[model samples]
Target: AYIAAPEKTAQAISTMSPSLITFKLEGDHLNRLNIPVIRRCLEKATAVVVGPGLGLHKETEEALKEVLRIVEEKGIPVLLDADGLKAFANFKRRLRVPLVLTPHAGEYKILTGDTLPGKLKDRIEMVRRAAQELNAVILLKSNVDVISDGVRVKLNFTGNPGMTVGGTGDVLSGIVGAFLAQGADPFNAAVAGAFINGAAGDFVKAEKGYHMLPTDLLEWIPRVIDDPMSHVKVRRSVPRGL
Candidate 1:
């Protein structure tokens, strides 16, 4: 369910217009996502996705903390994106369940406390170190997505420039969350999720080129998932320790 005040709700609704459930905030945005409500909603959730469009307003950050708390306490597998990456600044060591972090270069720097490297090898090593240190899978988004859980790395090459548009990462978080909920391990889920998310973008790009929007990419995800090879030209697997 989408949870935020009216103004935020309008923006979220525009992005997630297809969402089937929504919980609008009545007053303090933080207060709106109280533990009681979180717990109740979690009871029915197989996996949780947090931090998409979650702004850094103080109240929203507080709400993020509560969301993190419930997710940890309940051992819910979760995919953290956007503001959720900011929230991880505090809870990095507290993660106890299967968790995935999707961060672009800037966010990855903030989360890892290191400068993003210029070369591909250095970047892969950084992602690996961050995943190992945090004990979570990391999907470091870029032109060529890098996914690692410290032990293994998967490079996804199915997307295009069109996916740089806003809301694409949110679509990725949902895809990964769905995979995790369906019992894919954190690493494989991230691998497959990255593959699927990018492949969908490629599919949309085939039709719309650089004009493809996030909604188009979102709509194409299932199609890519159902016929992955059709999107990925050559399926190459990275070595276990690469």
Candidate 2:
């Protein structure tokens, strides 16, 4: 709703690559969202991704809630990441739409008020519990990404320290959003997203080491998704977290 920069952001996105990706400018302040332009966008969206660069302003929190209400009515799949997670942290309503949440350790603790355990097994259990309570697929980013949708849990081990750079998490969110848009179930979309993102990161690490940027990992995503098992060798050769 209130993006800080529409023209600059749009220009930047235009240069990133080519396709049918388009963006609308709803003005530069959160209050502009009150004009209800978001409904128009949601009408055509297959999946919705919230957060990324969304600011933590109170207006943003309110705007996100409004978006959630619309999606719930439409039964659209929505993924909450970054600021979207922060906004939803206090929302107390039951939503019927398909929902997915991606939070790193810090965000996870903030979202659920749990001090995430040190051991991997304990951490996975905590995430599973959180998924059950939240009634959404939770993808916890860490040395070994853990994904759970209350009933089924999956672990992904294909990334390296090279993915710590900025924009990498946003890239992961985009990958997950794409899967959801393609009509994958919440759990399946998250599972494939986690593995593909990490595998792409591992591929980038092989060539650029820790200097890889989010863009560097972008080219490898389709490759990884096309032949996910292709990274099995790398996954085995590299120890967890690298």
Candidate 3:
């Protein structure tokens, strides 16, 4: 079930083969997700993904506050992204439930108010510090994706340039959310999700080259997860007349 506001966002979600239970907010602004609807949904949800297509508008700040309240009260694992980053950037209190933050470099800078360092070691350290400070897992997306839970940092190299398209990150969050709902620990869920998302992107790259879309990446997800270590074995044939 997806709680989406924008027509295009909703339409994009509709294309996916899931029964979506829609939510309403006044007007085009996704600021106020229906509280009663969301609360009801949370009762059945083991984990929740917030801020996928959620837009950051002035009015929606209140909605984010409500989301936080419900998450805190219910102890639900949540994966925050997009405008949720904006809400998270401003939230000051200590987080209660297991939380994962999926942020790109720009979003990381926005969240911490510090630019990531140029060197790899320093970048890893920076993410470590952010995770430790927030006491949450941070999945920093880059050419080499970094996952850190303050204690350990894992770098993911499974994805390719073909994954640069929009909504791929959303797919990552969804996969992670699924794992968390299925009772995988937060850090492990993040590590596995990042690897699978990137590996699926890599697989899609092989099949469709760089022209693949986020939807194309979806098809490879099950294959990647099922046979994660499997790869196309390149065969070398001798010249026929050799």
Candidate 4:
């Protein structure tokens, strides 16, 4: 069975636990998707997570728009990340709900329609501005994640470079999606998701060092969440120089 949302879907085998389910979507044609089926799924879901391994394509863009429309009309909170952010770059104003957008620097440029100043402070400011313009929360991913909902800004300093492997962002999207399903607000979901994702990365890095893979990070998530103190000392110290 699959849990369909505005931008992404989490599918699982009935026998498997929810946390073990994988969340990813192919950026194929939206026309191929049955809107009625999707709408039915959304009618039973709490929130939706979009992006995560979704590549950019014209068909995918149109599909995202339709999904966003459905979510807005239904009044469900949505979390946008990865290609979801890219798809809405030119049409952000069309969105009419409280949204949480998670984007890296490159993706941030696309969403804001502005160039970053190549400095951390400037980029954080850009994220704040983007959140204000879109009337949504912005979670700018980096060494120090910055989150803003157009008013207050929060910084997350829990991750290390060892977490840079591919698919980690996808995992993060799923984590936030899970929190949303459990009834957390968008901003709290983003904040807790960032912390948990980073802490999981640190936990894996301690066991496998820099050679750790994204899946390794996922495997450590339970450990981090279950025993935050145990993994707190596992994080690699950030160096001072570039």
Q: Which ten residues in a row have the lowest lDDT in candidate 1?
A: 233-242
lDDT of each: 0.76, 0.81, 0.79, 0.74
Task: Choose the strongest candidate by lDDT.
Answer: 2
Give lDDT: candidate 4, residue 57. 71
lDDT of 2 by residue, 157-212 (tens): 77888788878888888888888988999899999888888899888877777788
Superposition TM-score, candidate 1 onto the true structure: 0.86
Reference-based TM-score of each model: 0.86, 0.91, 0.89, 0.84
Question: Per-residue alpha-carbon lDDT of model 3 for 1-242, expressed as tens digits?
Answer: 55645555556657765787555444666555566666876788889888776777766778878877898899898888877887678764558889899999899988899998878799999999889989899999887888999999999767776677888998999899899999899999999999888877777766666787888878878988888776432101111110
Model 3 residue 242 distance off true place after TM-score fit, in angstroms: 40
The full ranking of all candidates by lDDT, starting with the best, is 2, 3, 1, 4
Candidate 4 TM-score over all chains jointly: 0.84
RMSD of each: 4.5, 2.5, 5.3, 3.8
Deviating ranges (above 4 Å) for candidate 2: 1-7, 32-35
For residues 1-242, write the lDDT of model 4, one tens digit per residue: 24433233344332346543332333333432646656766787678887875557777777778878999998888888888889888677736766888888788878886776768788778788778878888888888889888777888887777667777887888888888778887788888889898888776666666777777777777877788776546654532122
Candidate 1 Cα outliers beyond 4 Å, as residue runs: 1-19, 232-242
- Model 3 spans > 4 angstroms off: 2-18, 24-26, 232-242
